[model samples]
Target: MSAPETATPTIPDYAGDPNAVLNDTNAVWRHGGPPNYSNTRKNWEIAASFKSFLTDWRTVDPNKYTFVMNGGEPQSAEHMLRSNFYSPLNNDFESSHKTFKRMMPTFAWEVLEVYSGPPKVAFKWRHWGVMKNDYVGYNDKKQKVRVKAHGGPIDIQGVTVATVNGALKVEKLETWFDPLSMFKQVSKDNEVFIDEDSA
Candidate 1:
């Protein structure tokens, strides 16, 4: 008897708003960039996580999985990006609508309902930063107003924000990068979420 032909796992198609991508108007920019594939497992973790969220792809529960294990040995950067990063990004992009719904209760509920990209849960470690300038409702002392975003309290402790560069400047120091860090050693400083001013 012949074995049954198994179907290949496919990524879902998602559309994005041109303005949000080009201008970076989305709320996620407040934290930093979108979630990225840092390793093979993280990539798959995100893929599986989001796939579970999708109404259509919920049925895909593959028994056989691919991953590297306990040792410090690592996979090639390109391979890591291909397998891990793109998959979750693609999945989130498809379900941005639902993602926003899941996220809205956690953060400031007043901003635009539609989102341009993935949520901060999808944010790579690099996006975490300290605020440089004062953001309205972002700083409690100044405005004393609390707003929520992405299903979390924005003004809460340890919730990373773009830290003040000086008095008026808000900047993000890249503790992590997508392209270069993929292959090289992850800096000790990068590993620790220290003061945001240091780049």
Candidate 2:
């Protein structure tokens, strides 16, 4: 008996709109398929709205409201932007969004689980992408060698906590993920290996 041939997954085509790319089914993959939560899972539109806010922060008017992001770090009332740490100070949405876009130029989120509640909705998803441009630390090594690009597909799981108003706009979002693992993968793909023996 011959084995059945599996179909190859095609890269999503997004007509130049960065936010539209997330809607591509071919780009998203869930481990056990999509989870079936009570209210949130059944409400497909909520998921779509959540995803839209993620892919495009501008989807919501920033001048009208502020968004918050927490990366599982210690709680702080202030919002600050530092070179290190994903947990930027609250209220620095613009800088944070700019930083995020610069780091992950080409990316997609595969939603695995979602929980909708009053004033807040949370979802667990996988963030997958390729580093097409040089981003901060990762760029230093590539730029020194004059390399145009670095890093392969990055598949990492993360959880996002968001507050959505009645208007369906994301008022705040908090995310948690393993930064060490992400950086390690980027380092490997960029050929910026560290000598463990020397250390």
Best model number under TM-score: 2
Q: Clashing pairs in model 2?
A: 79-89, 79-90, 80-89
Tens-digit lDDT track for model 2 on 1-96? 999999884432231234342344442322322223332222322233333243333333244434344554433222343322233432144444
Q: Over all chains combined, what TM-score does candidate 1 have?
A: 0.18
Off by over 4 Å in 1: 14-127, 138-199
Angstrom error at residue 37, model 2: 29
- Against the hidden true structure, what lDDT does model 1 obtain? 0.25
Per-model TM-score, in order, reads 0.18, 0.43
lDDT of the candidates, in the order given:
0.25, 0.46
Q: Write the per-residue lDDT of candidate 1 for residues 3-103, one digit (tens) a residue.
A: 99998843322212212222322323222443333322222223333332322221122221122222224321112232211233333343433332243
